[model samples]
Target: MPNFKLVAPYCGVRKYDKRFFVYYLETEENIRREYIFNTDEDVSNFSHALENLTAFMNNVPVCKKEAYHQEFLDLLLREVDHKLNIRTDPSKPSAVALAIEA
Candidate 1:
């Protein structure tokens, strides 16, 4: 497997809307991939996840395929419970509400 170098992981709010956030990972070959989030909490969580993944990549010898596969599994596991929680609890506080309280 070819080893690709990754750099410049960034996250920030979109200028047009404060509620929207964007994050991306850039590679040495200049390819960029981005994710847009509707909630600040999601963006924050993604940023933390990316940081942890980068750290793991740096310390581990795994290839990109393995790393990405692990991340995909993690996301799938998280989304299942997250979506279920939202659907099961109509009275749950939203990300916006949590942010305001904080």
Candidate 2:
């Protein structure tokens, strides 16, 4: 439905740990989405990456890969924060906030 492109990339390495960063744009919405790749395999496989990503968005389990799973959850939270721009208390009735929290 939309064409997307990467606009920026950042990497942080600490000892044996590494993070791959991506900032991208979608023409259909004029939105810049950020992504962090937690594992090297995530950077290499287009198919598994897509599947892993979809599963993450749907809030499905990512098998044994907790790091990658958490990355997606964080991205979704950032998106909610970008949209809401509010300090959401845990007790509040924020469907948007609650969905993200979920």
The TM-score values for the models, in the order shown, are 0.38, 0.21
For each candidate, what is the lDDT? 0.37, 0.33
Tens digit per residue, CA lDDT, model 1, 10-64: 2122222212222222222222223344566665665555456556555545446
Tens digit per residue, CA lDDT, model 2, 1-102: 112222111111111222322222212222222333455554344324444564444454435344554475466445332221212233434332223235
The 10-residue segment with the lowest total lDDT in model 2: 6-15
Clashing pairs in 2: none
What's the count of clashing pairs in each model shown? 0, 0
TM-score of 2: 0.21
